[model samples]
Every structure is written in structure tokens, then in C-alpha cells.
Target chain A: MEPILFTLFGAIAVGGALLVVTRKNPMSAALSLIMSLFAVAALFVLRQAHFLAAIQVIVYAGAVVVLFIFVIMLINVPENRLPIEKPTVYRLLGVVAAGLLMIEGGLASRNFSAPATAVGEVGSVEAVGHALFTDYLFAFEVTSVLLLAAVVGATVLAKKKI
Target chain B: MMGPSAYLILSGILFAIGAIGVVARKNALIILMSVELMLNGVNVAFVAVGSYMGDPTGGIFAFMVMTVAAAEAAVGLSILIAIYRLKETIDITELSVLKW
Candidate 1:
């Protein structure tokens, strides 16, 4: 049962991700990205990481991809104006790199051994909160600062006049 | 039956596809979507590892990655909007102002 769910969500994630890349329309692409993110969140849930899955959907698919779609709607991009150049050399290089990466990944995967079972008390929201406050407090604070900087930077960039 | 290795392999393939999309796509928005694909691939790998290792740190890291991805999309789109405003086109080839 778990395996079936994993395969289903994994297929959804991969398929949606491919659609995100293949779609020509920016809105479609953004929507496809949202689908992919949601599928990934589902995968997280299948892995028993409920909090991460919730955060994934809320933060990534909910906020981020919507922002992409919003900006896509704001911009007046004509489909015909897009560059259609077919650079054979670049495509060949990309294929070669992808193949090499797959080979390396397969080789590395051979060494990965799954632990006995998924028994972790730290996956609960309470445990996560404790760790965030105790061990990862500094990193948490830094992330807050980073988010503030990004918000300010985005505002400045979007504004026409200071 | 599927295992952590299967998930990891799928994640790798997805990441590679995203990388190719980023390199091959001409539209900035499409590139951004490809970037999201890559991030999702990483998140899958993170969760899979977390499950296999019996640790929650990987899941937490995936959450962090999501937040960073949001920030990236916000800032990237805003920059794209600014560039579109100035040039009236989002084509990367035409934005070569440094070309002599």
C-alpha cells in the first residue's frame, strides 16, 4: 500500500515537473510548477514528514508559484518573440552532462543502505519546534533576517521611483 | 517494491530534466519553473533520506529549502518585471547591452 502511494505521488511529481519545463506559456508553466510542488509535498507525507509537507504546500506552491504566475500575468510576453534558435552543440552538451550525472547517481545509490525502520520521534511538530528553539536557534534567526532582506529587495526592485 | 534508492533515482532524473530545461528554455519564466522543478527534486530526496535514516533533520531541511525557494521566486520575478519594463521584451538574447 505504501509502495503504491509512493509510486503514484512520485510519478505525479516527475510528470508535473516535466510539464513545468515543457509548457510554453508562462502561466501554464507556473501552474505546472505548483502541481509539481504539491506532488512533492505528498511524497513528503508518504515519507511520514507531515510538517514538511504542509510547509511545502503553503510556502512553495501556495506563495512562490503564485508569485511567478502573478508576474507572468503582469508581463506582456508574446509567444512569437521567444528565441527559437536550435543550438545543436548546447543540446548535445546537455545530453552528455545529464547522462554522466545519471551514471554517477546510480553508482552512488549502490552504497546507500536504508536504516532498519522509520522510527523517529523528531518528526513531530513539537519535536521540530524544540530543535528549532534549542539547537537551530541561530539559524532560525538568520533565516528570518534573510527573508526580511528578500522582501525589502523585491520591493525596491519592483518600485519605479524612490 | 520501491525503496529509498528508487526515490533517490527518480529525484536525480527529475533534477537532470530540470537542469536541461533551465539551459534549453529561452523564456525566463520557464527557466524559473525549471528551477522550481530542481528544488522539488531535492525536496523529494531529502524526505526520502529522512525516512530511510529515521531522522527528521532532512524534513526540516526540506522546509528550509521551500522557504528559500519562495524568496528566490519572489525576488526573481520582481527582477524579471523590472527588466521587462525597461526592455519591453523578456527575451534573453535581446538583453545583450554589453555586446559591441
Candidate 2:
């Protein structure tokens, strides 16, 4: 059962990611990215990180991809002028590098084993909230400050003038 | 239960694909998207390991990573917008003003 679920969501995510990279149209790529994000969210559910999964769907697929789509439309680059490059030697090199990395990862994972402890319904929002406030309190506050800075920076950067 | 190895392998493949996309894509927006993909791959690993270890720390870390990723996407797209305004093209290859 677990293996079947993994196969299903894994296929969606990997396939969607491939489409995102290979698609010519930015909008289409954005759509495929959303698909991948959703699949990742599903995988999160399988892992029992229910809260994180919800956040992934809401923040990533809902907000982030929509944001990308808006920017894509705002830029409005003509389809004919889109920066679609033909495959080159550099791209081939990229493929080789990726293949090497994948091979290394697969080899490394062969000996990987889960710890003896069971995860068992421990990733609820309440548990995460407790940890976020207690153990990770400082980091949590820093994240808020970082987000505030990002908001300001984005506005200033996107504005016509300072 | 699916072993951690399966999840780790999937994350690795996703990350590799994302790295390739970053290297091969000339469009700045696509590169940004690829970076997001790489981040997601890392998030998957974090959560998977956390699950395997029976530790909530991994999930919290993944959550933090997601927060950072969102901010990054915002700032990156804004920078892309500024770049487009300046050069009228989002092609990283074409925007070689800083090269010389």
C-alpha cells in the first residue's frame, strides 16, 4: 500500500517537474509546476506531515504559482520572442551532470534504512506549532523579520522609482 | 512502510532535474522556477528523514524552508521584473551588461 502510494505521487511529481523544465511556454511551465507542488503535498500526507502538506498546497500551489502566472502575464513577452533556445553542448553537459548526480544518489540510498522509532501520527499542526514556538523560537521570529524585509525589498525593486 | 531510501532517491532525482533546468534554461523566470524545484526536493528529504527518525524537527525545518522559499520567489520575481524593465528581455544570456 505504501509503495503504491509512493509510486503514484512520485510519478506525478517527477513527470510534472520534467514538463516544467521542458515546456516552451512559461504559463504551461507554471501549470506543470503547480502539478508537481500538489503531488509533493500529497507525498507530505503520506509521510504524515499533514500540516506541512496543507501549507504546501495553500502557499506554494495556490499563492506562489498564481504569483508566477501574474508576473508571466505582466511581462507579456511575445510568444514568438520567447527565449526558447535549441539544445546545445552546454545543455548536454547539464544532462550528463544530472545523470551523474542521480546515479550517486541512487547508489547512496541503497544502504539507507529508517530508524527503529515509529513516526506514528506525530506531525500534527499542534505539535509543529509547539516546536516552532519552543525549540525553534528564535528562528521563527527571524523568519518573520526576513519576510517583512522581503516584502519591502520586493516593493522597492518592482516600483518604477524609489 | 516505505523506507527512507525510497524518498531520498526521489528527492535526489528531483533535485538533479532542477539543477539541470537551472543550467540549461536561459530564461531568468524559468531559472527561478527551477530553483524552487530544487528547494522542494530538499524539503522532501527533510520531511522524509524527519519521519523516519520519528522527529518533528524535520517537519518544522521543512516548514521554515518553505517560508524562506516563498520569500525568495517573491524577491526573485521582483528582481526579474526590474531586469525586464531595464533590458526589455528576461534572457540571462542576452543580459550580459555585467560581463565586461
Candidate 3:
């Protein structure tokens, strides 16, 4: 049962990612990204990180992807106006580099050992909140400040004028 | 349960795909999305390790990564919007004034 679920979600994640890269339209790509994000969230659940899965759905699939779609609509880049250039040297280079990275990363991960069972109830919201408020308090506070800065920056940058 | 290596390898593949998209795509928006993909890949790895090691700290770090990712997406998209307003196009290849 577990392996079946894993395979299903894994296929969704990888397949959606492929669509995100291959699609020419920004809106289509954004939609595919949503699929990929949802699949990743499911994978989180499979790993027993329930809270992380929820956050992934809310922040990523909910907010981030919607933001991308909104921008795509705002710009409304005409399909014909886009260059639609033929494959070039950069495309080849990108494939080669990506292939090498995959090889290296796969080799490194070969020694990883699976945990027989979850060590803690880290998947629960309470457990995560406890850690966030206690052990990671400083980092959490810093993240709040970072988010505030990002809000201000986005508004200032996106506005029509000062 | 699946081994940590499986998740890690999946992350590697996803990250590589994101990297390829970043390099191959011309649109700044697509590149930003690709950046998000790479970040997601890293998050998966963090969670896997944290779960395997029996430490919640890895999950904590993944939370931080998500926070940073949100910030990055907000700021990056805004910058892309501003750039489009200025140049009327979002293709990074043709808008290379920074190629000095």
C-alpha cells in the first residue's frame, strides 16, 4: 500500500515538473507547477510530515502558484510575440549539466539508510509548533522580519509610481 | 517505509530538472518557477533526512526554506513585473543590458 502510494505521488511530481518545463504558455506552466506542488505535498504526507504537507499546500499550491498565475495574466504575453527560438547551444549545455548533476547526486544518495519508524511525532502541528516556538524561536522571528521586508519590497517594486 | 535514499534521489532528479529549466528557459517568470522547483527539491531532502535521523530540526530548516522561498517568489515576481513595465518584454536573452 505504501509503496503504491509513493509511486503514484512520485509519478505525479515528476510528470508535472516535466510539463512545467515543456509548456510554452506561462499560464499552462503555472498550472502544471500547481500539480507538481500538490504532488510534493502528498509526498510529504507519505514521509509522515503532516504539518509540512499542509503548509506546502497552503503556501505553495495556494499562494505562490496563484501569484504566478496572476502575474502571467497581468502581463498577458502574446504567444506570437515570444521568440519561440529553435533549440540552441544553451539547451544542449543545460541537458549535459543536468545529466551530470543527477549522476553525482544519485551516487551520493546511494548510502542513505531508511529509518524503521518515525523518531518523534514531528508530523503533528503541535510538535512542529513546539519546535518553532522553542528551539527555532530566533529563526522564526527572523523569518517574520524577512516576510515583512518582502511585502514592502513587492509593493514598492510593482507599483506604477512612487 | 521507503529508504531515505529514494527521496534524496527523487530530489536530485527534480533539482536537476529545475536547473535545466533555469538555464534553458528565456522568460524570467519561467526561470522563477524553476527556482521554486529547485527549492522544493531541497525541502524534500531536508524532510527526508530529518525523518530518518529522528530529529525535528531538519523539518524546522525546511520550514525556514519555505519562508525564504515565499519571500524569493514575491520579490522575484515583482522585479519581473517592474522589468516588464520598463522594457515591455520578459525574455532574459534579449534584455541583456547587464552583459557588461
Which candidate wins on TM-score?
2
Best by lDDT: 2
Q: Tens digit of lDDT per residue, candidate 2, span A48-160? A: 99999999999999888898999999999998888868888879988999999999888877887877875666578988898899999999999999999999999999999
TM-score of each: 0.93, 0.97, 0.96
Model 3 alpha-carbon miss at residue B2, Å? 1.9
Alpha carbon lDDT of residue B11, candidate 3?
A: 89
Which residue segments of model 1 deviate by more than 4 Å?
A85-88, B98-100
Q: Candidate 1 - CAPRI tier?
A: medium
lDDT of 3 by residue, A17-64 (tens): 888888888888899999999999998888789999999999999999
Selected candidate, larger lDDT, 1 vs 3: 3
lDDT rank order: 2, 3, 1
DockQ of 1: 0.66
Between candidates 1 and 3, which one is better according to DockQ?
A: 3
Give the Å shift of residue A128 in candidate 2: 0.9
* CA lDDT, candidate 2, residue B46: 94
Q: How does residue A153 of candidate 1 score in lDDT?
A: 91
Residue A102 accuracy (lDDT) in model 2: 90
